[model samples]
Target: MSTRFSIEKLGAQGDGVAQTETGQVFIPFTLSGEVVTAARERNHDRATLMAVLEKSPLRIEPACRHFGDCGGCAMQHLEEAAYRDWKRDRLVQVLKGARIECEVDELVACAPHSRRRVTLSARRTDAGLLLGFNRHMSTQIVDLDECPIALPQIAGALDMLRELGSLICATSKAFHMTVTVTASGLDVAASGSGRMGERQRQIAANFAVRHGVARLSVDGEIIIEPQKPVVMFEAAAVPIPPGSFLQATQGAEQIMADLVGQHLARAKKVTDLFAGCGSFALRLAKKSEVHAVEGEAPALAALDRGFRYASGLKRVTTEKRDLFRRPLTFKELNAFDGLVFDPPRAGAQDQCRQIARSDVPLVAAVSCNPVTFARDLAILLAGGYRLIRVVPIDQFLWSPHVEAVALLEKPRKRR
Candidate 1:
């Protein structure tokens, strides 16, 4: 049945929320203060937006034609000022919910078309290979003619990548290709495609060379390497692993590194937990001795190499250990005067508990998820650490994801 709803606010997932007689209803692609008519699904409070009887003043035209249909972005319809405020408010709300109160800095804006890394889905169709993002709430792929969120080099090569997918695709099933635009050139990595024969492998290699791709890999195995894919972390040039994790944009990474470096500047020794390719450790080593701990061996090796070749840097050591399995204990953490940790979405709960018990004076906590970040901050707060401030970074522009760097300090008791 159709129902009338006045959107009250946007939920954490970027859906519009309405307080109805029955309960709160969530409608996709809606804005606050808009009167929307939607049809409720059977046995569910969530509704599908049918019409916007009244539009919000904060609503604006989306940049991409695939805004609503493509699942890549949700808040493109919101105006710039309102959108940034909303993103920053999300981090504040999460911190309040966790009962960890602190001042939050204004949102750090990342420009569109700044994304260097993108993962696209591809499948063999009757006509040819289809490539793009999956449609909203469906498994169907939306073939892209253009994507405003991706770097121009990546967006312009959509059709060429689709053609490359056809050659690499050994089965009728769908696969994923991660394209990263590095300093050398494009690094394409394909996975979930069936094994290729020698002839097919030869064709793939030829396609990569002819198209000027820096490197190509299938299921983590390197197929062709015309040039090394090197990504600079500050002064260090680190060779990136295929399909490895990197900050969405270089601007956001610099902001995060600056915040982290500023917090740990005075310390003589620092430990970076969950360090991936030495993003923070390389920059931190400018002032302090750094020990980087990571689970991925390849990433740790890259960090070690970057440290050795880079000149005028302090001592940098790496340890390959899964922090989730073996979090550094209080005694181990006590060796470092400063610490910085940037864990994945599943935030470092076990590690935070140990840090809380330790006496590290200066600490910088970086996170991609605000919820888990807030939870971890609460632990540190309970251990008497005073939060200096939290800065929210919008690296994934027009998307729900937000990155943050939080600084904290704990004073030592006098004897």
Candidate 2:
């Protein structure tokens, strides 16, 4: 039914909520107090905005040309201060939902084009090869002229990347192309591109060389390396594996590393759980001994080598283990004076459960998903850990995603 609706508030997923006679419906690209007409689907809460009868003052021009259709950003239409506030409130609301309230520091901001990494989708249509991000919750790709959220080097190279995509377009099926701008050069990794043969591999190798892409890997296999892809984590230069996890922005990373380092500065020994490429471990090692634990051997080896060559650092060790299946027992965790775990979006529920039982005096938890972060924090709170402060960091600029670092301390008596 096409009907007029008054937007009540913004939902958790960046949709505007409106209460209907029957129930509530969510409309995207809307703001609170705005009156808009939308087509509501039967038995569905989502509505497609048709027109805005009344506009909110908060609504502003989006930064990118492809704001609504690109699916790369969510809140680019909202005014700057309001966007930041909503992002910070996202963490607050998640914590409230988990019944864990504490001081949430102001959000650390991220700038446009600061995104050093992005994953693009590729496919060949009648027009030509399409290379860009997919539409929201969709398999459809939006061919791009420019992407304001990505680093200029990557954004400007879209035509080149599209041309290169044609060379490796093994099948009609879409594949993911993750491009990361490192200290050396662009590291391109394509997955699900079907099986690549010798001809395509050689062409892609030559393309990487001609374009000066530091490395190219398909489906976790290196196709070519014009130069070894390396990134600087604190003082260490770590050789990163293709498609390895990296903080979206260098500014956000430095802020997180600084927060983690300051939280555990007094400790003599620190354990960096789920440490990737030593982003926090090597930085912490300047003052305290660090044991970097990660699931991927390549990531762990990269960390070890970064630590080995880096100067003026304390002792650093590495362990390859999956914490989700085999969490460090409380007995094993008690050996560390401090602990920091930066888990993936699923959060670190299993490890946090073990950390709750550990008498480790200090703890710093970092996560990209607030929902799971709050769930894990509740587990720690139940085990007598005091929540100190949670700082929300804006890593994925203009997107709904936010990063957070939660600091907690176990009581002296408990230790």
Candidate 3:
């Protein structure tokens, strides 16, 4: 027997919620107020999109052929505007749950098809080389013939590389590829002992050569290297490597960096934690002294380069420290009057705790996950910090992810 239910709220993982007579069931590809026929026997607790008996106004056709199976995109079925609204609503709910009161500005949304970087998994299967994202909630690999979000040129390369991987056999399991687009050309790196063999490298070389690519690197060696690095963000061209972290959208990164500059206007001695390639530090130096800290050594090297090339009155310093294990001490924290934290989705809970216990007067936290940000906000509030403002910045487009910057001020002393 199947029980019917209506979706009441959207869950954190982009699943629609329905209150069944027995319990709540989460069905994918459904929107709020969507009354769809769901098979409630998949996970023994009643979870399945049996049929879309009724479609909500918010429903839309997903453009990607591998939408349901590919794990990279979950909300492709949702209309673009509706998807942004849902994500903004979720952020509001999270802030309320954490007792942080603030107004939510218009949610910024990135373009649907502006992804310049993509990481695909390769597996040796009986059929051949299966190159694609893992299937949702399973280890199954979904073969993606074409990706709607990736750049056209990279997408073509993906198709060609898939065949090349299959032919080499040595490239089957050991191959991992990251495709990045620079202003000059596309950059790809295939790594693993047997992965990206001589034949695969030759294929990449020929593809770049025929396409008139400016740069190409395989297995730590440059085949068609450029004389200078290609700039992704303003005045700064990141010589991105095989495994470096970069914003997927070049246009969106410029906007994000601009927002960072605005947020650091009044900052004096600023500390940028989890600073990658000095994205915030170099720019922040135009307005204030910046101390950049990051865990990755290569990123630190890039940050140093950015600092050296930076032209201005403000000073810049670099520190390679792992905040996860060894956060800044009170004495260390006292050097900075303000801090700009751009942590990963994990959020910097331990570092937040440390900052809350310090005397820093101003803070600007850039976050990708609202839940973790709320958790960290609670700690800051407990330490006498008042929520100032929250600005949503859209970095990842067409996906459920939302990036936001929250400003906090220390409370006045009671005399």
Candidate 2, poorest ten consecutive residues by summed lDDT: 406-415
| Candidate 3 residue lDDT tens string, 41-115 | 667554667677667888888888898778878788888777888778878888998888889877877775678
Candidate 1, 136-239: lDDT as tens digits: 66789988889998899999999889999999999888899999999999999999988999999999999999999999999999999999898999889898
Residue lDDT tens for model 2, 1-415:
6789999999888989999877899988899999999988665688888899999999999888887788778888899899999999999999998999788999999988889999999998888999988876578898899998888999999998898888877888998899999989999899888787898889888988999989988889998887889999877999998778999899999999898889999999999999988999999999999988999998998899999999999999999999989988888998998999999899889898899998888999999999999999999999999998899999998888999999999975552
lDDT (C-alpha, whole model) for all candidates: 0.92, 0.90, 0.74
RMSD of each: 1.4, 1.3, 3.4
As for TM-score, the candidate ahead, 2 or 3, is 2
Candidates arranged by lDDT, highest first: 1, 2, 3
Better of 1 and 3 by lDDT: 1
Q: Least lDDT summed over 10 consecutive residues: which range in candidate 3?
A: 226-235
Model 1 regions more than 4 Å off: 1-3, 413-415
| lDDT winner between candidates 2 and 3 | 2
